[model samples]
Target: MSVVVSFKVRREVKELMDKYRDRVNWAEELRRFVEEKIRQLRAEENLAEILEELRKAGWSVPKGFSVKSVREDRDSR
Candidate 1:
Protein backbone atom coordinates (compact mmCIF):
# COMPACT_ATOMS: atom_id res chain seq x y z
CA MET A 1 0.00 0.00 0.00
CA SER A 2 1.27 3.46 -0.88
CA VAL A 3 0.02 7.00 -0.38
CA VAL A 4 0.81 10.39 -1.71
CA VAL A 5 3.21 12.55 0.22
CA SER A 6 3.97 16.11 -0.74
CA PHE A 7 6.04 19.00 0.50
CA LYS A 8 7.14 22.36 -0.82
CA VAL A 9 10.74 23.29 -1.46
CA ARG A 10 12.29 26.66 -2.16
CA ARG A 11 11.96 27.85 -5.75
CA GLU A 12 15.71 27.62 -6.25
CA VAL A 13 15.78 24.09 -4.92
CA LYS A 14 12.88 23.09 -7.10
CA GLU A 15 14.64 24.52 -10.11
CA LEU A 16 17.81 22.61 -9.28
CA MET A 17 15.84 19.39 -8.88
CA ASP A 18 14.10 19.99 -12.17
CA LYS A 19 17.44 20.42 -13.86
CA TYR A 20 18.45 16.91 -12.82
CA ARG A 21 15.02 15.34 -13.15
CA ASP A 22 16.14 13.14 -16.02
CA ARG A 23 19.16 11.87 -14.06
CA VAL A 24 17.55 11.32 -10.70
CA ASN A 25 14.68 9.27 -9.34
CA TRP A 26 13.47 11.95 -6.94
CA ALA A 27 10.62 9.94 -5.41
CA GLU A 28 12.81 6.91 -4.70
CA GLU A 29 15.58 9.14 -3.41
CA LEU A 30 13.24 10.87 -1.00
CA ARG A 31 11.69 7.57 0.07
CA ARG A 32 15.09 6.06 0.87
CA PHE A 33 16.13 9.14 2.78
CA VAL A 34 12.95 9.08 4.84
CA GLU A 35 13.28 5.34 5.51
CA GLU A 36 16.88 5.76 6.68
CA LYS A 37 15.91 8.66 8.92
CA ILE A 38 13.15 6.59 10.51
CA ARG A 39 15.54 3.71 11.13
CA GLN A 40 18.05 6.05 12.78
CA LEU A 41 15.40 7.59 15.02
CA ARG A 42 14.03 4.17 15.99
CA ALA A 43 17.53 2.96 16.91
CA GLU A 44 18.03 6.01 19.13
CA GLU A 45 14.66 5.48 20.79
CA ASN A 46 15.44 1.79 21.45
CA LEU A 47 18.82 2.71 22.93
CA ALA A 48 17.17 5.27 25.23
CA GLU A 49 14.71 2.65 26.45
CA ILE A 50 17.51 0.15 27.11
CA LEU A 51 19.50 2.75 29.00
CA GLU A 52 16.51 3.67 31.10
CA GLU A 53 15.93 0.03 32.02
CA LEU A 54 19.58 -0.36 32.95
CA ARG A 55 19.41 2.77 35.08
CA LYS A 56 16.31 1.53 36.88
CA ALA A 57 18.06 -1.77 37.64
CA GLY A 58 21.15 0.12 38.89
CA TRP A 59 23.45 -2.12 36.84
CA SER A 60 27.21 -1.48 37.01
CA VAL A 61 30.34 -3.33 36.05
CA PRO A 62 33.56 -3.44 38.01
CA LYS A 63 36.51 -1.56 36.55
CA GLY A 64 38.64 -3.74 34.20
CA PHE A 65 35.82 -6.31 34.02
CA SER A 66 35.76 -6.20 30.22
CA VAL A 67 39.53 -6.41 29.89
CA LYS A 68 39.73 -9.34 32.29
CA SER A 69 36.91 -11.17 30.53
CA VAL A 70 38.56 -10.71 27.14
CA ARG A 71 41.91 -11.96 28.46
CA GLU A 72 40.29 -15.09 29.91
CA ASP A 73 38.43 -15.86 26.65
CA ARG A 74 41.63 -15.51 24.60
CA ASP A 75 43.55 -17.76 27.00
CA SER A 76 40.86 -20.48 26.74
CA ARG A 77 40.88 -20.41 22.92
Candidate 2:
Protein backbone atom coordinates (compact mmCIF):
# COMPACT_ATOMS: atom_id res chain seq x y z
CA MET A 1 0.00 0.00 0.00
CA SER A 2 1.13 3.54 -0.63
CA VAL A 3 0.13 6.97 0.62
CA VAL A 4 0.47 10.52 -0.55
CA VAL A 5 2.38 13.20 1.31
CA SER A 6 2.16 16.92 0.56
CA PHE A 7 3.71 20.04 1.97
CA LYS A 8 3.67 23.76 1.35
CA VAL A 9 6.70 25.68 0.14
CA ARG A 10 7.56 29.29 -0.66
CA ARG A 11 6.97 30.52 -4.19
CA GLU A 12 10.71 30.70 -4.93
CA VAL A 13 11.32 27.30 -3.50
CA LYS A 14 8.55 25.81 -5.61
CA GLU A 15 9.88 27.58 -8.68
CA LEU A 16 13.42 26.28 -8.10
CA MET A 17 12.08 22.80 -7.51
CA ASP A 18 10.08 22.97 -10.72
CA LYS A 19 13.18 24.06 -12.63
CA TYR A 20 15.15 21.14 -11.26
CA ARG A 21 12.26 18.78 -11.89
CA ASP A 22 13.02 19.06 -15.61
CA ARG A 23 16.42 17.48 -14.98
CA VAL A 24 15.47 15.02 -12.22
CA ASN A 25 12.61 13.14 -10.64
CA TRP A 26 12.50 15.26 -7.49
CA ALA A 27 9.57 13.37 -6.00
CA GLU A 28 11.35 10.04 -6.26
CA GLU A 29 14.57 11.60 -4.99
CA LEU A 30 12.76 12.98 -1.93
CA ARG A 31 11.10 9.60 -1.34
CA ARG A 32 14.46 7.83 -1.32
CA PHE A 33 15.97 10.45 0.97
CA VAL A 34 13.03 10.16 3.38
CA GLU A 35 13.15 6.36 3.40
CA GLU A 36 16.90 6.32 4.13
CA LYS A 37 16.50 8.80 6.97
CA ILE A 38 13.63 6.78 8.43
CA ARG A 39 15.70 3.62 8.36
CA GLN A 40 18.64 5.36 10.05
CA LEU A 41 16.47 6.78 12.80
CA ARG A 42 14.79 3.42 13.44
CA ALA A 43 18.18 1.70 13.67
CA GLU A 44 19.41 4.26 16.18
CA GLU A 45 16.32 3.81 18.31
CA ASN A 46 16.67 0.04 18.23
CA LEU A 47 20.33 0.30 19.29
CA ALA A 48 19.42 2.56 22.18
CA GLU A 49 16.80 0.07 23.35
CA ILE A 50 19.27 -2.80 23.13
CA LEU A 51 21.83 -0.84 25.18
CA GLU A 52 19.23 -0.13 27.81
CA GLU A 53 18.39 -3.83 28.02
CA LEU A 54 22.07 -4.67 28.39
CA ARG A 55 22.44 -2.10 31.16
CA LYS A 56 19.42 -3.55 32.91
CA ALA A 57 21.09 -6.97 32.78
CA GLY A 58 24.26 -5.52 34.35
CA TRP A 59 26.29 -6.28 31.24
CA SER A 60 29.69 -4.56 31.31
CA VAL A 61 33.17 -4.92 29.87
CA PRO A 62 35.95 -6.02 32.22
CA LYS A 63 38.85 -3.70 32.95
CA GLY A 64 41.15 -5.80 30.76
CA PHE A 65 38.89 -5.41 27.71
CA SER A 66 40.30 -2.88 25.23
CA VAL A 67 39.40 -1.23 21.92
CA LYS A 68 42.00 -3.51 20.32
CA SER A 69 39.92 -6.51 21.36
CA VAL A 70 36.80 -4.82 19.95
CA ARG A 71 38.53 -4.06 16.66
CA GLU A 72 39.82 -7.60 16.44
CA ASP A 73 36.35 -8.94 17.08
CA ARG A 74 34.93 -6.77 14.30
CA ASP A 75 37.73 -7.66 11.91
CA SER A 76 37.09 -11.38 12.57
CA ARG A 77 33.65 -10.93 11.05
Candidate 3:
Protein backbone atom coordinates (compact mmCIF):
# COMPACT_ATOMS: atom_id res chain seq x y z
CA MET A 1 0.00 0.00 0.00
CA SER A 2 1.11 3.59 0.74
CA VAL A 3 3.09 5.10 3.58
CA VAL A 4 3.29 8.68 4.79
CA VAL A 5 6.48 10.53 5.65
CA SER A 6 6.19 13.66 7.75
CA PHE A 7 8.64 16.45 8.50
CA LYS A 8 8.84 20.18 9.13
CA VAL A 9 9.91 23.19 7.00
CA ARG A 10 10.28 26.96 7.13
CA ARG A 11 7.17 29.19 6.96
CA GLU A 12 8.21 31.12 3.83
CA VAL A 13 9.19 27.95 1.98
CA LYS A 14 5.94 26.26 2.92
CA GLU A 15 3.89 29.15 1.57
CA LEU A 16 5.85 29.17 -1.69
CA MET A 17 5.28 25.47 -2.27
CA ASP A 18 1.55 25.73 -1.56
CA LYS A 19 1.29 28.47 -4.17
CA TYR A 20 2.84 26.34 -6.94
CA ARG A 21 1.71 22.90 -5.76
CA ASP A 22 -1.35 22.86 -8.05
CA ARG A 23 0.68 23.66 -11.19
CA VAL A 24 3.32 20.98 -10.58
CA ASN A 25 3.51 17.39 -9.37
CA TRP A 26 6.57 17.73 -7.11
CA ALA A 27 7.34 14.02 -6.79
CA GLU A 28 7.30 13.24 -10.50
CA GLU A 29 9.23 16.36 -11.43
CA LEU A 30 11.94 15.63 -8.86
CA ARG A 31 12.27 12.01 -9.98
CA ARG A 32 12.69 12.91 -13.66
CA PHE A 33 15.33 15.57 -12.98
CA VAL A 34 17.44 13.29 -10.79
CA GLU A 35 17.26 10.37 -13.22
CA GLU A 36 18.44 12.48 -16.15
CA LYS A 37 21.43 13.88 -14.19
CA ILE A 38 22.53 10.39 -13.09
CA ARG A 39 22.34 9.07 -16.65
CA GLN A 40 24.50 11.89 -17.98
CA LEU A 41 27.20 11.38 -15.35
CA ARG A 42 27.51 7.59 -15.97
CA ALA A 43 27.45 7.52 -19.76
CA GLU A 44 30.15 5.55 -21.67
CA GLU A 45 31.24 8.64 -23.64
CA ASN A 46 32.45 10.20 -20.39
CA LEU A 47 35.92 8.65 -20.68
CA ALA A 48 38.07 11.52 -21.81
CA GLU A 49 41.32 10.50 -23.61
CA ILE A 50 42.62 12.38 -26.64
CA LEU A 51 41.95 15.97 -27.74
CA GLU A 52 39.61 15.09 -30.62
CA GLU A 53 38.19 12.25 -28.55
CA LEU A 54 37.37 14.66 -25.74
CA ARG A 55 35.83 17.09 -28.23
CA LYS A 56 33.71 14.75 -30.38
CA ALA A 57 33.29 11.32 -28.74
CA GLY A 58 33.43 11.77 -24.99
CA TRP A 59 31.83 14.07 -22.40
CA SER A 60 33.52 17.45 -21.86
CA VAL A 61 33.31 18.13 -18.17
CA PRO A 62 34.72 21.21 -16.48
CA LYS A 63 36.12 21.80 -12.99
CA GLY A 64 32.67 22.39 -11.51
CA PHE A 65 29.35 22.13 -13.26
CA SER A 66 26.24 20.25 -12.22
CA VAL A 67 22.53 20.35 -12.99
CA LYS A 68 21.44 19.33 -9.49
CA SER A 69 20.63 21.92 -6.85
CA VAL A 70 19.65 22.05 -3.18
CA ARG A 71 16.07 21.00 -2.35
CA GLU A 72 13.68 22.11 0.39
CA ASP A 73 10.17 21.09 1.46
CA ARG A 74 7.16 23.16 2.41
CA ASP A 75 3.82 22.12 3.85
CA SER A 76 1.38 25.05 4.13
CA ARG A 77 0.96 28.81 3.95
Candidate 4:
Protein backbone atom coordinates (compact mmCIF):
# COMPACT_ATOMS: atom_id res chain seq x y z
CA MET A 1 0.00 0.00 0.00
CA SER A 2 1.20 3.49 -0.85
CA VAL A 3 0.48 6.48 1.29
CA VAL A 4 1.45 10.13 0.96
CA VAL A 5 3.25 12.13 3.56
CA SER A 6 4.66 15.64 3.68
CA PHE A 7 7.62 17.25 5.39
CA LYS A 8 9.59 20.46 5.06
CA VAL A 9 12.99 20.60 3.43
CA ARG A 10 15.48 23.42 3.37
CA ARG A 11 16.63 24.97 0.12
CA GLU A 12 19.92 23.05 -0.04
CA VAL A 13 18.23 19.72 0.66
CA LYS A 14 15.78 20.32 -2.14
CA GLU A 15 18.65 21.08 -4.50
CA LEU A 16 20.58 17.93 -3.54
CA MET A 17 17.50 15.72 -3.80
CA ASP A 18 16.83 17.09 -7.26
CA LYS A 19 20.46 16.48 -8.16
CA TYR A 20 20.14 12.85 -7.07
CA ARG A 21 16.57 12.40 -8.16
CA ASP A 22 17.21 8.93 -9.57
CA ARG A 23 18.34 7.71 -6.13
CA VAL A 24 15.54 9.13 -4.07
CA ASN A 25 12.80 7.06 -2.41
CA TRP A 26 10.95 7.85 0.79
CA ALA A 27 10.42 4.47 2.46
CA GLU A 28 12.29 1.29 1.68
CA GLU A 29 15.43 3.00 0.42
CA LEU A 30 16.64 3.82 3.91
CA ARG A 31 15.71 0.37 5.16
CA ARG A 32 17.65 -1.23 2.34
CA PHE A 33 20.67 0.94 3.00
CA VAL A 34 20.68 -0.04 6.66
CA GLU A 35 20.18 -3.74 5.94
CA GLU A 36 23.03 -3.84 3.43
CA LYS A 37 25.29 -2.11 5.93
CA ILE A 38 24.47 -4.66 8.61
CA ARG A 39 25.28 -7.49 6.23
CA GLN A 40 28.67 -5.99 5.38
CA LEU A 41 29.58 -5.42 9.01
CA ARG A 42 28.66 -8.97 9.95
CA ALA A 43 31.49 -10.15 7.64
CA GLU A 44 34.14 -8.12 9.41
CA GLU A 45 36.79 -9.71 11.65
CA ASN A 46 35.99 -9.69 15.39
CA LEU A 47 33.67 -6.67 15.15
CA ALA A 48 31.81 -7.41 18.38
CA GLU A 49 34.98 -7.95 20.35
CA ILE A 50 36.42 -4.68 19.07
CA LEU A 51 33.34 -2.78 20.14
CA GLU A 52 33.56 -4.33 23.57
CA GLU A 53 37.19 -3.23 23.78
CA LEU A 54 36.22 0.32 22.88
CA ARG A 55 33.59 0.28 25.60
CA LYS A 56 36.07 -1.01 28.10
CA ALA A 57 38.70 1.59 27.14
CA GLY A 58 36.18 4.45 27.46
CA TRP A 59 37.42 6.09 24.27
CA SER A 60 34.08 7.57 23.32
CA VAL A 61 33.35 8.10 19.68
CA PRO A 62 33.19 11.69 18.58
CA LYS A 63 29.81 13.39 18.60
CA GLY A 64 27.61 12.53 15.59
CA PHE A 65 30.03 9.93 14.16
CA SER A 66 28.26 6.66 13.40
CA VAL A 67 30.30 3.51 12.81
CA LYS A 68 27.93 2.44 10.04
CA SER A 69 28.29 5.79 8.32
CA VAL A 70 32.05 5.52 8.42
CA ARG A 71 31.92 2.02 6.98
CA GLU A 72 29.65 3.13 4.16
CA ASP A 73 31.98 5.97 3.20
CA ARG A 74 34.99 3.68 3.21
CA ASP A 75 33.17 1.07 1.13
CA SER A 76 31.88 3.65 -1.34
CA ARG A 77 35.36 4.41 -2.62
Best prediction by TM-score: 1
Worst 10 residues of 3 by lDDT: 68-77
Off by more than 4 A, model 2: 67-77
For model 3 the local lDDT of residue 35 reads 80
Top candidate by lDDT: 1
Cα RMSD (angstroms) for every candidate in the order listed: 3.1, 4.0, 17.8, 13.9
Sorting all predicted structures by lDDT, with the top scorer first, yields 1, 2, 4, 3
lDDT score for candidate 2 against the true structure: 0.94
Instruction: Write down the lDDT that model 3 would get.
Output: 0.66
lDDT tens per residue, model 2, 1-77:
99999989999999999888889898899899999999999999999999999999999988868987988999999
lDDT of 3 by residue, 1-77 (tens): 74554558899978988899999887677678878988887664454335567577766865444332212222221
Candidate numbers sorted by TM-score from highest down? 1, 2, 3, 4
**What are the runs in model 4 whose C-alpha is more than 4 Å off?**
1-11, 14-23, 46-77
lDDT of 4 by residue, 1-77 (tens): 85555668999988888788778774567568767998888867478888888999997968767977888999999
TM-score of each: 0.78, 0.77, 0.41, 0.31
lDDT by residue for model 1 (11-59), tens: 9999999999999999999999999999999999999999999989999
Looking at model 1, the pairs that clash are none
lDDT of each: 0.98, 0.94, 0.66, 0.78
- Give the better candidate number (1 or 4) by TM-score: 1
